[model samples]
Target: MTIHRMLARLAALAALALFAQPAFAAECLLGAPGTTQRVEVSDTGRAMTVHVPGGVDRIRNLPLVFLLHGSGGTGAAMLESSGLAATSDHHGFLLVAPDAGIPVERGFVWNIPGVPTITGEIPTEDDADDVAFLAGTIDWLAERGCIDPDRVYATGLSGGGRMTSWLGCVAADRFAAIAPVVGLRAGNPLPDDPQRPDPATCTPSRAMPVYAFAGADDTVNPVAGGGAGYWQYPMDAALARWAEIDGCREEPETVAVSDTIEERRYARCDGQARVVGRVVAGRGHEWVADNEAMWMFFWRYRH
Candidate 1:
């Protein structure tokens, strides 16, 4: 082979390499075990705390869970109230909680679509940009090492739950599964009133696995409509919508998990998706299970 021919072949190979998949790299700094470390989301100055599990050094390919708080709540509050950090410690998964910045007391509120606050005001899109912050958090974590890209999951309470549903709708490509505690049905068309913002446009990238919970006695986001002007629908209706989105077969199997809990499981879904709803009897708007059920549900899925 001539020198010119060899040089041309090398250049061609180099050009082709540019189009190939790049190797994974961890650019962000890692956190310490059993501690919560705050990190900036971006130039936006939005911040979050990542709770590294106690045994992180011994685990590889860890699953990452984004735990969001309700309206007027903060990451610190969620970590304290949800009992998720202990769950993370027990399960060896990473947990992250981001601030929403709608200060009500010591906490904040996530700016979910169409949902207004107690004062009947909705935060504009640019006001929170939670979707971007979440996406950036995931990317930053993935780039930092020990994260299993396929094992990403999200769960939250009230406003945070709505945010989780939004992530399932808009960022489904990145999350393996989601559990929203008392969140609304994403992409369910709203009433034809022009005054209201259109329901969030849901375009899931895959047949997503969803395990949701709702309280029978909840009034904040009631099973029936008309409560503080927040989005309201029966738990069955929300589950049905998710089942349709997940391509599950009709007629879910119902089972009594406990005296206070009944589960409805959708079967034969495309892409191994499982859509489930758990109705908590005689309960109100709350994180009924310390988020253990959500973790178990999330554990079953991986992208």
Candidate 2:
């Protein structure tokens, strides 16, 4: 071949290879190993995306982690941004990211105010049965096999983070541990006012391990924000309340890891569940890169 023609052909081949690389990687990323399966599991028309590591058999009980997305986010976005799927691939666990079922202007939202009652009240468009949907999802995963029922855990950001708190309070029986990022309890007031429900009545079925992370400077959910609107309770106060709920006797030991990350842990609680709070120094409303550390914290507790 002529030198000029050979050079042109080589450049075209390189471009083709470059384009093929991402397509190949995406296929692998969205397939069997290190990928997710989309599932629709209810007459209620609820849908979820489940990511299972390759070669995981239905016989062995594998650890399951639920990664929930924030407001204006989707299951795929959470899996991509939180890096939990990569963690799942490395840690050999099954990761599931379920859609919140709320249609926002951009993406989807978790129905924070949509929890149901036994009165058979139908859920409105804004209302979602996220608690039941999650419970049902876990049950579905358990039936599929290879999932350890005792090791089911959950974590989320923003609105999803709020849903994680709701799961901890209302669906504690199903989850062994939970980590809510930049989210707090709705703490709805008591009485069956269709407008507001009490947070006090939403007691947990068991003491599950909880590791909370919030930026001291988070304007979206500030620790000092009044009432249940934002972070509501001060950071220390929220940790204290959780400690009290879990019956944790050990005082918090604060350890500054760096200029941007601080770790505070409360151990020796009832059911051996511990509460660890990470106060990100000078950070705002975002996920900490140390989520692997958070997962490690959540993995310690078993049902």
TM-score, one value per model: 0.84, 0.77
Candidate 2 lowest-lDDT run of ten: 22-31
- Cα lDDT tens digits for candidate 1, 1-303: 999999999999999998786865755454677888887765667788788898766435689998888877888778788889999998999888888756676777776565575557877665666777788777767776657888999988888888888888888889999988887556534556422223346668888888888888888877554455456455676677778888887689999998989989998898888898887899999986537778888888898
The Cα local distance difference test for each model comes to 0.78, 0.71
Clashing pairs in 2: 62-146, 188-197, 188-198, 188-199, 189-197, 189-198, 190-198
Clashes of each: 4, 7
Please give, for residues 1-303, the per-residue lDDT of candidate 2 as tens digits: 999999999999999989888331111122456557786764658777778776543324678888888877888888888877777766778888888876666677666554332222324765766777888876665665547788988889877777787788778888888898887453433344422335474578777688888887788767655433333455566566677778898888998878878877898998998887787878778886376786687677787
Question: Which stretch of 10 consecutive residues in model 1 shows the poorest summed lDDT?
Answer: 191-200
What are the runs in model 1 whose C-alpha is more than 4 Å off? Answer: 1-24, 58-60, 101-105, 193-200
